[model samples]
Target: MNIKKENDKEDNENVEVFDEILDKSFIESYDPSIIVENQVTTETNYGDFQHLGCYIICVLIIYEFLLLLLMGNITFLIFGAAVPNVIGCIGENKNYTFTENGCIKLYEIQKNESCIPIIENQFESIQSEYNLYCKEAENVKQTSAFLQMFAMMIGATFGGQLSDNFGRVKTIKYSLFFIIICCFLSSYATTIEVFNIYRFLGSIFVGTKSSVLHVLLLEYLPKQHRVWVSTIFSFSPNYIIFSFMAYYTKNWRDLMFVISFIGLIGLILINFVKEPVRWLIQKGKLSKARQSMIFIEKWSGKLTDNMEKKIFDYIEEESFKQEESQRRKKSYTFKHLFVTWKLTSYSLFFGYSALVGCFINYALIFNLEKVSGSIFMNTAYLGLIRWFFNISVGILDYYVKWFGRKTCHTLAMVTIILTLSIVLLNIYFPLQQQYIVRFATLFAISMCSQIFIANSVAQTELFPTSIRNIAVSFQAVFARLGSIVAPFLFGFQSYSLTLPYLIMVTMSIVDLTTIWILIPETKGDKLKDHLPNKDEWIFGKKNRELKLLKKVELEKKYGSRCN
Candidate 1:
């Protein structure tokens, strides 16, 4: 007995020695005090663990950098959709209405004088260069918006699939490379058609970079930080950049060049980004996973030996589960999304909510130029409200479990409805109150946008790993859909500014009703493990049949060898 006991002890010692040499990893994913007394425990040095927090912060910084860049691309619509208002110059003839169609500024080149189309400051846009005005103006702008959204949808659909098939880092690298190329080429386009094409193609690149980039950081972050990341990732707006840069970059070409350059910088910086160890394990790339774990552990600082074993063992078991899943059955496909009950319900409603959210967000942004002050200052205020609210929600989520996600989601919608109603009602009050109402509308927009972000954690949680990429990416699809239609809805301004607000208020009410019925609280659920039998239902697995079939296969394979 002593000999056997010594052998077991020696085996354990050998494993620990191997870990020390190999630098195997574990997480301080939980508080150290929660560990069982029988298990190995480590001293908590807040000073030492600060490095771990800083490392994660570094990851978040890189993540937000990429997100901000892609957001810069996604928000190109804010400018493109504004081209109609900004592109018009004084017509030479003043008789453009007689010959041409509606609302066109005619530039006639008399004798020796040059035909200067619409020149705003020192720069001109593609709309001016192509003379895409009059009846064609709205169509051109709407087409650009639609094409951008359509391309984004395609990129997101595939980006998610590729993130699942390859890895997050790989998807981002390829997508951003394509974006840089398209944007650089678009900058040099002499014609409107070519510029529009490039913009459409470039949006695909940004779409591919969107969901997966955020997911990479998400897998590495803890629960609290995940909310922080989610809020930032979801509420991304490039209005601040536009607000400031517009003062310098009056030329469309220069703007494209600058945006492309940022994308190139992201491509270079991405080299330092490590793929999540969870993804590596799922791919069955254990060697790469081990290396990533080493990076994580080195950053996380000293861990208990037992905790190290526990973390690694958990990873290894999950990897084995992935392999077993593949061997036992065919992988789940997109078709499985609609067939499942709860998933179908959640996806449909969330997608619609996302659609409404995007429309409302863009509708507000498209009208920034019309706001009665310095456009840059107005834009900056919108961005600041979003930031302040982002921090507010993150702090609230971390400190208080006051309301479940469902309740919070409903509350946010109701708040927007109430605030918007006040703004509308303020129209009847004195002129003094009208200014406050305008500010109130901005506040309402910020609150609505924040809810969309704070709820993103539910997206990553509700679906199984099998569908998470597409599930999250799918929300982007609907978001882009809303973006596509927003400018057209803003076209209602040709009738009355209040017309758009009236339509939005009606839509918000519908969205609130749908969300309440279809959505459930995901506030307390554990990430990735909240849903039961996800693997089974996701792959259309029924318990008894799968068990019986597995039993038959196992007996056939092993029975003859045993005999």
Candidate 2:
């Protein structure tokens, strides 16, 4: 009886030892929580590197070659480069001549005599008809601009939602199709009324494309390279394309045709481009995610079992890691975006939009005559300078380690204000010898206002991932609304060109102040680590609950052993 009892005790002790060893191995190999935390940092090798490289090369060749071909066509080139100039010229020239105390003497070919010939009896009637037509055309253009602005906002918002619901690729594909159709329709628009309709439709698709492109680019890159890739990728092509447009086409309709051709190529390219693997994983499409991983492995060499495990574990654990507040049983309607905290962000973002719209549309257009020799030269110089500044910033973004995102944004805002203030001073004081200084300052303002890129990154990071797209789209909508209102604001005879800048500066000051007070610093931190601490005041009672839960879990796992 004693020997039998001793054997049973020994067996029980052996079983406990084996269980501990198994638990340790399990923890080392497959702890989903740890995997989730570290997945962003994990360096995984993808297999079949040579094959993958070839595939990437092929895709790039196809896309780049087609893009170049479309861009190189004379009609495409002319439309892209020339139409914006015409638009800019018309928009600016009209604003300049019609403004309070503008030099309208130059526009007056003959003071009392009409440019068109008519018999004395019909002269007054002919003049009246011409004035009516001009007024009607102006109205059409204004209405078109407003519709385009609104459509862009709505499209961007809708695109973001669609991309979140469908895949990024699908959203982009649909947007491209819309763009293509609208562009073709725009080319055929006979009257200003039809033209405006096509433009509104086109703007809608363009807005969607813009949103999708940003989201797609961010998701396609590795986490560490996301900001750099996004900054460069987003702006460089736009500048190049716009620059080309500014240099070539005279007719707006021709430009529309060029853009449509580009859209067609973009649509074709979409067939070859892979859906973002990160997005695939996020949406719980594991098979597709793994397929993406397999494709990456072909280029990067084979990933280890541990690397594969980490990726899978991170996706699974992300749901649990969602903020407790976000996971609460609250209504999921879009109106939730208007909650106090969100509203604050939205207001600031709206101000940002207003600043952009006012500066780009009204102020810049109004001030162009004071800067450049002619409309064509002005556009060329403006496009070149803008491109140079954006490219310089893109290159600098990768190297600048000291400047925080907020600091850069703040500096840009301050620069804009200072530049505009100088312009305002120039107008009031009439700097006879400082015209060059005024022009240079305006140029700098145009170049530097792009600090919004950094601001956008900061905004995207602040919101949780679930609401990120919607938040961005809503902010864009407000910005578009600001854009729509800007033309009309400056349209008033009472308002000077400087008035819009002054308003922008005031709003910018508010934006800067709010950001300094309310916005948290988000530079150089991994995205996952940047979440607001549950213990912060903003989180309220939820913080304590989360902390308590964590404590309980820690105690259950390690209490007696640590003691």
Q: What are the per-model numbers of colliding residue pairs?
A: 0, 20
Candidate 2 steric clashes:
20
lDDT of 1 by residue, 75-129 (tens): 6645544443434333454412222221332333323343334433222445645
Evaluate model 1: give its lDDT. 0.65
TM-score of each: 0.76, 0.69
Which number leads on lDDT?
A: 1
Global lDDT of each candidate: 0.65, 0.52
How would you encode candidate 2's per-residue C-alpha lDDT over 1-563 as one tens digit per residue?
Answer: 99999999976765565456456563343233431222365433221111334444444444443333232221121222111111111232232123222223323533543333111111111112223323343354346556766777778768767776777778878877877887789678666567667767777876676555655554444444545544444433443554456446445555566767777877887888787665564455656766676666555655668757765665445444334334342322344344346545654664464456334433344334335354445545654665565556555655776655667666666766676677667767876777565455546445443555665666555654445556566666666666566545545535575675577667667766766766666665433322233333234444443344444445656787887
**Residue 266 displacement in candidate 2 (angstroms):** 0.4
Which residue window of length 10 is worst by lDDT in model 2? 80-89
